[model samples]
Target: MTWTLKLVNRQPMKEKLGLLVQHALKSGVAAGHLRPTEIPLSIALETPRIAAHGDYSTNVAMTMAATQKRAPREVARIIIDHIDDSGHLLSKTEVAGPGFINFFITQEKWYEVLKTIHDEYEAYGACQIGLGKRVQIEFVSANPTGPLHVGHGRCAAVGDTLAAILEAAGYQVEKEYYVNDSGRQIHTLGRSVFLRCRQILGDAIEFPADFYQGDYIEDLARLLVDREGAHLPDMDEEEAVGICARFAAEEILSGIRKDLEAFGVSFDRWFSEQALYDSEAVRSVIQDLKSRDIIYEHEGALWFRTQDFGDEKDRVVVRANGQTTYFASDIAYHKDKFERKFDRIIDIWGADHHGYIPRVSASIQAMGYDEKQCRIILVQLVNLLRGGSPVAMSTRAGEFVTLRQVVDEVGRDAARFLFLLRHYDSPLDFDLELAKKESNENPVYYVQYVHARISNIIKKAEERGYKHMCWHDDFTDLIKLPEEIQLIKLMARYPEVVAQSALLMEPHRIPFYLKELAAAFHAYYHDRNKHMVVSDDAGLSAARLFLVSAIRIIISTGLTLMGVSAPETM
Candidate 1:
C-alpha cells in the first residue's frame, strides 16, 4: 500500500523517440542519402492499435518523401538504416504500409515505465507543457435564485476537473464563480419573497404568475420575518422589497456555496454582478466603447456597433430609460478579467447560451481585445433517470433536482464520476439506479474496485511473508508475462493522456482512461494461476507485486484528478 517509491530519473519514451528520429534524419543528410535541408519542426509519434506492428509509429518518412523526391518507402529505409538500437530503447525498426516507420521498443525499456510510475506516483501523469501560463476557468454561474440543480452539477464537475488537470500540467489556474446578483431576476426574487412575507402576516394577496414559486422563497420570507418582526408590515412596500432582495440574495447564495462545497467544488473568487454597477465599471466600459466609436445612439438608446463587428445586429448597451442591459455588465466583467492579466480566460456555460458567445466575442473585439483570448465551453444538458425513465426538471418553476439531492442519493464520488463520463458538449443520460449499483456494470465501482483489488493483493502478499521491500528491489527481467506486458503498455500511456486532456481542456478523457486501465488490471487479475502474486518463485512474485503496486498508484492518481475518491475498500 506504500506509494512513496524512490524517484527514477529518466527521459520520457516519446521524447526519446523524437530525439532518435531526428538523429537518424541528420545521419541521412550527412551520408547524402537525401538532400541537405532543415529538419522537420515536429515529429508525430503514435501507438499502433495492433501490438505486433510496434510500440510507436510515425509518418515522418511520408512527409519527407515528397520533399526528397523519392518514394516514401525509400525514405523510410534510409532513416531506418541510421537508427541505432544500441541504447536498447528500440529493439528493431520496421518499414510498414507505404513508409510508416514503426519502432519496436525493448521490453527492458517498457519496464522503466513502471519504475517511472512508481517513482512519480501522485505526480505520475503530470507534465509541464502548459509552460506555467495562467488560466481562469469560470463555471456554474447560475443566478442565486435557488439551489444548484443536476445540470449545475455537470458544470461543476467539468470546471473543477479542468482546473485540476491544468494545474497538474504546470499551469497557474484559478477557479471562479460569477454571481449574478444585479439583474431583473433579483427583483423578481425580491417580489416573490415579499409576497410570501405578506401571506405570513395574514394579508390577502394574489401571487403573480411571473414571480418565483419555490418553497425556498417562503423560507427566506420566514427568515426575514424572524429577524425584522412586526415592523416589516408597516414599512413602505418598495423599501420592504429592497431589504428583502438583499436578504434573499444572500440566503440563496449561501445555500449555493454550501451545495457546491458539498459537491467538492470551490472557487478562488466569488465575483458579484452588482459590484460592477456599484463601482460604475459598467458606465466606464460604455464610455470607453463610445470613445472608440464602437457605440452610438440609436432609437434613443446607446447601441454597441455589434453588427459592424460580425453580430447579426447592433446591441443596445443602455436602454432609452437609462437602465444598462445585462450584456453591458457582462462586457464590463470580461473587460475586468482581461485587465487582471489572465493569459487565457475560459467560460463554461450551459448549452442554451450558445447564441451569447458571438455577441460577447464581438464586444471583446469592439473593445480592442483579441476575441481568441476568451473561449467558451458550452456544457450540454444532463438527463437524470431512474430505472430507464427520465426525471423531471424545470428551473423556471424551481422543480428541478438539486445537486445536493443527487449527491445525497448516490454520494459525491458517483455523482462526480458519472457527470464526467462523457464529453461536455454531449448530452448525458445519468441513470440514478445504475450509479447506485455496486456491480461491475457501474463504472465508478468497476474503476474503484481495481484500486481496492490491488491493495488486497499487496495485503495478501505481506500476509504470506513477502517483504514490502521486494517492490523497491529490482525485478525487471522477471516481469515478462503476456498480461503483464499488456498492462504495462496501457499504464505507460497515462502521462500522454494527461497532457492531451490538459491541452484540450477536456476532463472526460480521465474517466475513459481509468476505465481502460481498470479493464487491463481485471484481465491480468483473472489469470490468477499464471500471474500469481505470492508464488514460490521470489523474483516473479516480487515483480508481479511491483506491477500491481504501480497500477494502484495510477488508479488513485486518475481518480483524484477527476475529483472522485479512490476507495481502498469499495
Candidate 2:
C-alpha cells in the first residue's frame, strides 16, 4: 500500500510534545496522587490575548479533575510534584489561577537557548513531519485577461509561502499556476486584440464594446504587426478572431509570468486550460456525463444536472451554438488534476468564487473522489492603502496597480511579508507608503531589522576575537534569569508554530511568530551593552554567545519558512 508515501506525516510532532507531558503526568500518578496533564512547566507556552500570562500556561489539570472525579487543585498538585526537576531554566513552578499550572523560567535558559540556536543554526526549528511527502500547491491562477493586481498578489504570496513552509517541514512541494487560456474569455481577448490590430493597420473595423481596454492592448497589437506586418492580409471575422485570441493569449501569459517573477513567484507548472480542449478531455467528460444521465437536453443546449449532485441550479455545459462553457473545461481540468494522482488538490481562489465551492466539490465527489481531497481557499481582497486612505484600483478602467508596481514600490521582501502578515481570512490593508518606509514603523522592517542587528552584534563579537569559544558553555551556569529563560522556551516553540501554520493553511502565523520572537530578542539586546556579558569571561561569554546563536538560527528558520531572505548582515 505504500509505494512511497507522498504526503506529510504531521502528527508525530504533536505526539512527541504530548508524550512528554504524559510522562510527567504518569510519574505523578505512580506517586498515588491525583496526576493530571495540567501542571504547566516553567514559562507558560500559551496563546495570550492578555500579555501578562508569562508565556504558556496550562489548565489541563482543571479540565481533567471533572473527568477523573477529583478536585482540580488536588490534580494540579499531582502534576506539579512529578515534573522533572532537570528543567534547568525553570525558576518557580506554581499551581495558580483556578487549578492552572504556571512556571517561571530562568533568564540563563535564554542564553542557553541561544546556544541551542547556534547548535542548530542551519536547521533551527526544522521538523521532519513532512517526511518528504510530495505536495502540489496551485495559486494566483488569475485569468490572463488583465495584469495582476493586489488581489492576485495575495494568492501568490500565500500559496508560495504555504508551499515553502510545507517544503521546509520536509515535504516535496510543487508550486503551480493554472492558466485559463482555453475559455470564452480568451476568445474575447483575441477578438479585442484583432480589432485593435486592424484599426492600427488603417483597416475599417468595428470594435467590440466588451473587449478589454488597456494601454497594454496597443503593445499586443504592435507585436502582432511586428510579427505579421506584410503577411497580414485583410482578415474576416473568423480569421481575425482566431488570430487575435492566440496572439492575446500568448502575450498576456507572458505578461503574467513577468509580473509574477517581479514579485518573486515561481511556478513549476503553467498548465494550459486549452490543453483540456486539445486532449478532448472536455468532450470525453461531457460524453461520460451523458452516459451517466447527468447530461440532458434543455432549450437546444446541453445542460449538466449538477443539481442532482447538490448544485443549486443545473449548469449549461454547451450553448445552443455548440460552444463549451467555462465550467465544462473546469470540470475536466480538476478531473485532470485528480488523474495526475495527486493525493491532494489545493486551489487558492478569489473570494468572489466562494459560491462555486459546492459545485466544484460535488463534481469531485461525483467523479469518484472524496470531496475533502479538493480544498479551496478563498482569500479576501487586499485593500491597498496609502497614508491611511484606501486606494481603489479598477482594471476595467485600466487604472489597476500591477504586482510589479507594488514590488517595485516597496521591495519584494516588504511586499511579501506584509501581504502574509495578516490572517488570510481577515481583510489586509496593504499600505504602500508604510511598506516603502525605511524605518521600523513597518512590522516587516522591525522583524528583519532584528535579524540584521543580531548579525551585526555577532560580527562585532568576532571582531573582538572570541570566535572559538563555546557559545553555550557559560550560559549553562547563567541560565537563571526569568527574561532569559522565557526567551529560551519561546525558541523551543518555533517548530510548534510552524506545524500549526502548515496544518491550518495559514501562512500569516509565521509572520506573527517572527514578530513575537523579535520582541524577545529586542528585549534581551536593548540594555545588554550596559550590563554586558564579558565575552572573554569564557563561561559568561560562551553563555551569551549561545543566546546570540539561538537568536540567529531562530530568525533564519522563521525567515526561511516565510520564504524571505535572512541575511547574515542586513
* Whole-model Cα lDDT of every candidate shown, in order: 0.88, 0.75
TM-score of each: 0.96, 0.87
Rate residue 548 of model 2 by lDDT.
Answer: 59
Q: What does candidate 2 score on TM?
A: 0.87
Tens digit of per-residue lDDT, candidate 2, span 60-125: 777778866788877777767767856353566677778877655444444533544455566656
Candidate of highest TM-score: 1
Q: Which is the leading candidate under lDDT?
A: 1
**What are the per-residue Cα lDDT tens digits for candidate 1 across 1-570?**
133222223456786788889898998899998788668976889999998789899999998888899999999999999886557788878999989999988888788888888767799889888899999999999998888989999999999999999999999999999999997888888889988998999999998878998788899999999998957768898898888898999999999999999999999999999999999999898998898889899888999888887889888898999888889999999999998899999999989899888889999987778889899999998999999999877767768788899999999999999999999989999988998999877899899999999888788888888876434436766887777888888888898889999989899999999999999888888887787777888777888888888999999999999889887776
